[model samples]
Target: MTVVRAKLGAHLHSMTAPFLFVGSGLSRRYIGTEDWEGLLRKFAALTPRPYEFYRTSAEGDLPAVASKIAEAFYDIWWDSDDFSSSRKKWAGSMEGRESALKVEIAKYLSVPPALTGLANRESLEIEILKKAVIDGVITTNYDSLLA
Candidate 1:
């Protein structure tokens, strides 16, 4: 890990404000968000089938399982009154569609992680990162944690 970090640090130092490629692991460490499979499994609980079934059926292909979950979840979302608020909110845009999965993901990630009351090195790191002289930011993260 140290070697990887050192190499990446050297690479970043070479470029003038190079775009940083942040991934899920960074969010997992900083904010306690689940990894991809764990996130898929969490949504799978709302589907007709268990998470394991989707995993096995998809041959452990997580994206495939995610598609399956999306399809099943759409049915539930459209037919249930519990999601009426979702429907009303997203009406005329993505209503009566499988896009509820996107909304669910957004809602799941919208909550910012609590970083207060931290008199620690990591908090100092965050402060430094906030003042970092990067050209811009790029991330695969779905949340607005850095925004």
Candidate 2:
């Protein structure tokens, strides 16, 4: 979150405050969300094929690999006890066989992580940003941390 403080001040205006554009890094710093590849790797573990298989099959295209992984998870999600509650909650959104992977991803991200690991610098950054005069917060991330 140090970037929040640093960048917010750079474009301040007297008439109108600046809007902070937070990319995908906030979760990585605050909650340690893995990068896209690593995130898919976690889900890949549930499938019969290894993550490397998906990587090779997709020819290094992460989105393609994600889709393939989602296809794999669709088969597992319908029968796995691990996703029983998820199946009940998301049966509507699944559209018969799709979006189960997204449901799993949302479930994983929605669980709050422990904040005890916050460093002194990050704490100070939070304090500084709390007092920052800004028009609003914007983030590429889908989480509601700023919203």
Candidate 3:
């Protein structure tokens, strides 16, 4: 979680906020088998269009290629009203969805390295954050996981 903390610190410094707010989202730790299936389902919901779009595009500039992938991801992310709205609520109007996704992606990136040698790999620091945010953690990304 140090990376998460460091990034957050850098962000707060850059923003120089009179008011700063945070909301919790899902970690892999929160996901159960069913929840995992559900998130995969959501991801699957958007994959085909993006995949096809990318497939059809003959010329691929690196930036354009990346943008195409993002557009596809956004298709899945934005389609579900509850999912999209929860993100907005958790993020408030101040933070962008990309910022939220970055934090989540970072957590996913960091967890594997940190837990590499552990016995019970799934249960770790995320539990503490989960407890702290029982009421406040409002993102739909992990709702099924927590439930």
Best by TM-score: 2
Residues 18-62, candidate 3: write the lDDT tens digits: 422232333343332224333333333445653335534625443
lDDT of 1 by residue, 60-139 (tens): 98788888888888988778897888778885688444588778877788888777755588688778877878777778
Model 3 regions lying over 4 Å from their true place: 1-46, 50-52, 55-58, 81-90, 93-107, 110-147
Q: In candidate 2, what residue range of length 10 has the lowest lDDT sum?
A: 138-147
For candidate 2, report its TM-score.
Answer: 0.81
What is the C-alpha lDDT profile of model 2 across 16-131, one tens digit per residue? 87788776687678667776887899999999999999999999899999999999989799899999999898887666444999888878877766656689998787678779
Q: List the candidate 1 regions with Cα displacement exceeding 4 Å.
A: 1-15, 95-97, 117-119
In lDDT terms, which candidate is top? 2
- Candidate 2 Cα errors over 4 Å, as ranges: 1-12
Error of 1 at 75 (Å): 1.9
TM-score winner between candidates 1 and 3: 1
Better of 1 and 2 by TM-score: 2
